[model samples]
Target: MVETGTGTLPTYTETLPRIPESARTARRLVDLALTVWDMNEVRDAAEMVVSELLANAVHHARCESVRLTVTRLSDSRVQVSVVDRSRAHPRRRAAGSMEESGRGLGIVNALAHGRWGVDSLAWGKRVWADLEVTSGE
Candidate 1:
């Protein structure tokens, strides 16, 4: 089940199929949440990070289910996380030009602004990125 905070800040989460479509679904969810929170300023970066995270989960996690979560930590900060039923940790690879893959983590790192990480869970692992929301957002 998904969890949402009742006081001050709110969190939204959902479990999705570990299929290719989930990546798109993740973007839609992030867009909707940012819209509702009046955080559209960070929408582009958030969506890009979410796409990379979800794509990584679907392609590398080797699990049947994935959980996507968006948390509003404060008025100026938000976090997006993906949990997969795989224990394997992901590493960033050095990809050359014309390489179609192996740059998911790199993208996240570049866009997350030094605020992304992986946490080992009892059943699997959760990868998350923290983005700074603009005040006027």
Candidate 2:
């Protein structure tokens, strides 16, 4: 069963491994989307953010685990965060020539309903985004 805080559901308090090819992949994220709250649009956005963040973590930092957090915030929005032991923070670069990447954060920022960022504390950094939940519940 998922836990809740007042109106928030699930809270996204999961710590999965950060292996390159861990089974806790897209399907697992989608499963969480369905089980966490209830909104098709929100699910898709959250799943995309999670997948991108997870992929970035593995591809760039080579992390072996991430802390996933999903919390329903005020003003009808869902905040998604994936914390990893990144060597450093994410860098925002323009679309370079023949570049096949460097647009994940921009996508997250565009889709989310509110402010989002990738920051680190004493331990490491966390990549998070927020979106308006349209579950209609």
Candidate 3:
């Protein structure tokens, strides 16, 4: 993979309050970034991934704010990550068919084609997902 600062892979970041209402805003941010980066190919999946990650941060991370980062890695790959002020990392577990929750990471894994993981930050942790950029119909 090429380095991010070669001017080919544009990036965007936004720090938002950790509130339930911020989830919608986060999705909109992803959509807008994808549009700006001309990576609309993966907008839907990227939006879903952002929403899930942001929602998890808001609901689980007992922090004041979170940062959302979106990077266009290439013509066909983009990475979305969320950083929060909590060390608690997310885990994937088998979700029962009838379960109403506990499936955010699962959805991310499926959408990202198993290209996702979490990293610990100085103050918290960041969860990221890399998804294929395709102009889906």
TM-score for each candidate, following the candidate numbering: 0.91, 0.76, 0.88
Question: After superposition, which runs of candidate 1 have C-alpha atoms over 4 Å from their true positions?
Answer: 1-3, 7-9, 135-137
Estimate candidate 2's alpha-carbon lDDT, on a 0 to 1 scale.
Answer: 0.68
Give lDDT tens digits, candidate 3, residues 21-61. 88888888788877877777788889889999998998899
Best by lDDT: 1
lDDT (CA) per prediction = 0.87, 0.68, 0.85
For every candidate in turn, the CA RMSD to the true structure comes to 2.1, 3.5, 3.8
C-alpha-based local distance difference test score of model 1: 0.87
lDDT tens digits by residue: candidate 2, 1-137: 13457654546466777764542464365557555465455776777777777777777765567777677664467777778776588766677778898887777777774478877767788888877855553
Of the two candidates 2 and 3, the one with more favorable TM-score, higher being better, is 3
Q: Clashes in model 3: which pairs?
A: none
Q: Rank the candidates by TM-score, best first.
A: 1, 3, 2
Q: How big is the positional error of residue 5 in model 2, measured in Å on the Cα after superposition?
A: 3.9
